[model samples]
Target: MSILVYINSNGNKIAKNSFEAVTYAKKLGDVTVVTNGKADNTILADLGKYGASKVLVDRSFDGTDEQQITRMVATAAEKVGAETVVFSDDLVGKAVAPRLSVKMNAGLISSATGVPQGDGTVPVNVFSGKAFAFVKANTSKKIISLLPNSIPVEEVGGSASIEEFNGNAGDTRVRVKGINRPEGDIPLPEAELVVSAGRGLKGPENWGMIEDLAKALGAATACSRPVADADWRPHHEHVGQTGVAIRPNLYIAIGISGAIQHLAGVNGSKTIVVINTDKEAPFFKAADYGVVGDAFEVVPKLVEAVKKFKASN
Candidate 1:
């Protein structure tokens, strides 16, 4: 089967989820990656380590407009005679996959957790990670938007041939005014470990402990919706049904009461550790480990413990 993977790049580097998507596609058949923007050939060639055989770089479009990106992907799929097209289940994927499916008349599996089974069915998260449902593509062409961190990325160790794709970039309807990136060592969506807090921290002044803990563990920082709504933290830090959904390897939620809406976003994490003073906090029921304690006392000690472990090692 011929496979085409659409990857997102930051002009200099490719997103981690995109590598996972390429790795996933490699399992099915020959993989070709399509990306836009100005990136070095070395950066594009690095995808070979993750199983991509070829890469199509389109410098004509910078990926500022989703419509143009959709067109670029469709054209590349046709050029490669791709039977399967894969994308990372991110903002870019969510916006373009549906449009590409419509244009190509392909069956789309959004938020796919795994590759197709022997029965040709794909498993996907449903009801906000509460359950799993299998879907099959009845069409000749198939499109899948894979969830980030669902598949572990492995380096197969090979180099891919790079070529320029001269495709048409449709007129842009959206214009960029400025770019305000979130502050963090790792972007929350791509982070393997995350340290998050809620209103129980009391105020923005108390966030120093959260940052200290996150720094110690090399984890990204997040907050509950209420904390972001109250301006105690930036909205980008909010994670919930109505905010950013994450599936980090480990999620340490401190002081969060874990409302159903909040759980909707983070329940996909591989491991959850909840720390709250209320023993009956809803988050504890979903957490793999629960610590019934006050954040003021627990967080400082936890930070010290992590620091000591690092020092000893």
Candidate 2:
């Protein structure tokens, strides 16, 4: 089967989730890449490492106008005779995949865990990742929005040829004025390992312990809703039902009692570790591992352990 993989980039280079998407697409069959703008040559070159045979760059895509971009993708799929179209279930994928599915009269399986097996059955997480369900598409064409970090990125090291395509991006509406990204080494949503704290940390002044542990673990730092509401942390750092949802490999919660709302956001994580002074903390029930201890004492030791391990290794 010929596959068309949407190459979602940050305009500078490939997005991490896009790399996973391309790697997943490569497993199905011959893979071609589609990008929005004229990315740097160095960025395009990295597509080769992931087994993309060809790269189609559309400069007309002004990074806005979903209708126009959908048309551009549909046209490309037709040109390549692609039976399957794959996307990373990121911001762009969430917006455009459904539109493209409607335009092409194709079946869409969002948050897919893996490629479709024989009988076209695909596995997906349901109900905030509390359960797994197998889904199948009856349509001739299939569009998949694979969940981030679900599939490992494999490098076949096959170089891809760059080709430019001319297309109409249609009316220029909904233009982005500017982006003010929060300063951090890791973006929370994309982080594989996340270290989050709650009200148990006391105040923002006592956040040094949390930061030290997070730094040692090389994980993104996050907070519960109340922590953000209290202005101890930025609102963008909040993770809950009303905030950003994450499905990281490892999530370590310190001090914050696991409220139902907070659990709603982080329930998708593969493993949860809760460290709370309250043995009755609700979060302990959901945790794969639990530590009933004070954050001030436990966190410092944890940091030292991580440091010592790194030094020894």
Candidate 3:
């Protein structure tokens, strides 16, 4: 089977989830990656390390126009005669996958957690990570949006042939405006380690501890919806059902009472550590490790420990 994998890059670097998608697609068939915007040849070729056989660079589009992207992907898939199309279950994937599915008359499997089984059924995350379900696509063409961090990435050691794709990007309706991004060391969705907090820290003045811990651990910083709503943190940092969803390797919650809406976004984390004074906080049930203590006392010690460990190592 021939597979077409759609990836997005931040001008200079490719997103980690895209690499995971490429790796996942490789397991099913020969992988061809399509990306837009300007990037270095070396950066585009790096997809091969994750099993991409070829990289198609389309410079016609610079920004994410979902409609245009759908058209480009459909055109590329048709050109390559791809039977399966793979995407990372990110914002771009969520927007474009359905459009491409309808355009190609293909079956879509969103939130695929694993590769296809022997019986052609795919495992998927259902009910907000509370359960798993298997889905099958009876159509000749299939589209899959893989959940981030569900698949491990490996380097197979080869460079993919880079080629220019002249696919139609459709009409441009969206105008380009200046982008205002939150200041941070790492993007939250792509971070492997994330340190988040809620109102339990008292006020925004106490946020230093959270930043200190995140910096020491080389982690991204996040906040609960209430924190963001109260203007203690940027809306971009909010992680919850009404905010950005993440599936980091390790998630550290400080002073945040775990609400169900908040858990919906972070429940997919591989390891969760909750620190709250109240032992009865709902987040503890979801945490792999729970510490009942005051953030004022516990956070400093944790920061010191992380710093000392880093120094020793």
lDDT (10s digit) by residue, model 3, range 124-182? 99888888999999999999999998988878889999999887996889997788877
Model 1, CA-based lDDT = 0.94
How big is the positional error of residue 57 in model 1, measured in Å on the Cα after superposition? 0.9
The backbone clash count of each candidate, in order, is 0, 0, 0
Q: Each candidate's lDDT (Cα)?
A: 0.94, 0.87, 0.93
Clashing pairs in model 3, backbone N/Cα/C closer than 3 A: none
Order the candidate numbers by TM-score, best to worst.
Answer: 1, 3, 2
| Candidate 2 lDDT tens digits, 172-221 | 65778887888799988789999999999899999998889889999999
1-313 in candidate 1: lDDT tens per residue?
Answer: 8999998888898889999999999999999999999989998999999999999989887755789988899999999999999999999999999999999999999999999999999999999999999999999999999999999998999999999987576778888888888886799899999999998999999999999999999999999999999999999989989999999999999999999999999999999999999999999999999999999999999999999999999
TM-score of 2: 0.95
Residue 225 Cα positional deviation in candidate 2, in Å, after optimal superposition: 1.2
lDDT of 2: 0.87
User: Which residue pairs in model 2 clash with each other?
Assistant: none
The parts of candidate 1 lying over 4 Å away from their true place are: none
